[model samples]
Target: MTKVWEASVRATHSFLSETSIQKIKISLPKILQQIPDLIIVEDEKIIAFMGISHQELEMLFVAPEFRGLGLGKQLINYAIKNFDVNKLTVNEQNPQAIGFYEYLGFETYRRTETDDAGNPYPILYMKRKEN
Candidate 1:
């Protein structure tokens, strides 16, 4: 079970390598120790969870049968309300996620480029300003 999550996170990091996902993964233990607001979506057969760090929200995943049901938004909103920070980074190439964040009132603050093992990718730094 833990192996599955590690693999999912690794695959997610591979897909969003521009966000320095590997660094985030490496630092996850510290992050979890500091901010342990994990939100889970569960059913009879499966469960999905989102793990958050101080400055980043990550692992927003849903089971195949549970996609497009506003669960992601629910999890993200819960995090925003519970965590002290308001910043998150996303791979610029993931249009759906970009749109999702935008829909939740997170705006792009800056753009970053990453060189991960000779691969280059774009990332967006997004923030929800405090009121």
Candidate 2:
């Protein structure tokens, strides 16, 4: 799972410094342990994962090899259907993620100049628009 997360981050989170990535890598296991609902896709090893809490999709990661294979969409749709996940935050620098979520009916409702850990990366708070 950690491998999946690291690989996904490395592939998508290009704005992150190696130092920040290292910090996140060190903390990801504990963070995953804390998510109230953790979902995984596996084939011998984990191929993708999601962390949900309080109706929010806290994290989603797909291995590079598994990307473009709809694994991310499947996991996110599962989270929305099963866990009532309607909210999530994405790094503003990650335009691909923004477009992905927007395609799934999410809209940005707020923005912050710094991430939760006080990092310089901008954050966008998004929610699934109610039908």
Candidate-wise lDDT, in order: 0.67, 0.93
Write model 2 residue lDDT over 1-131, tens digit each, in one string.
88888899999999999999999999988888899888888999989888999999999999999899898898899999999899999999999999999999999999999998898999999999999
Candidate 1 lDDT over 1-131, as tens digits, reads: 23334554554444655455556567666755664666666675335677788757855666534557887788888887787547887778667778888888889999878632344667788898655
Clashing pairs in 2: none
- Candidate 2's displacement at residue 86, Å, is 0.8
Off by over 4 Å in 1: 1-36, 115-118
- What local lDDT does model 1 show for residue 54? 70
lDDT of 2: 0.93
Worst 10 residues of 1 by lDDT: 1-10
| C-alpha lDDT of candidate 1 relative to the true structure | 0.67
Give the lDDT of residue 115 in candidate 2.
92
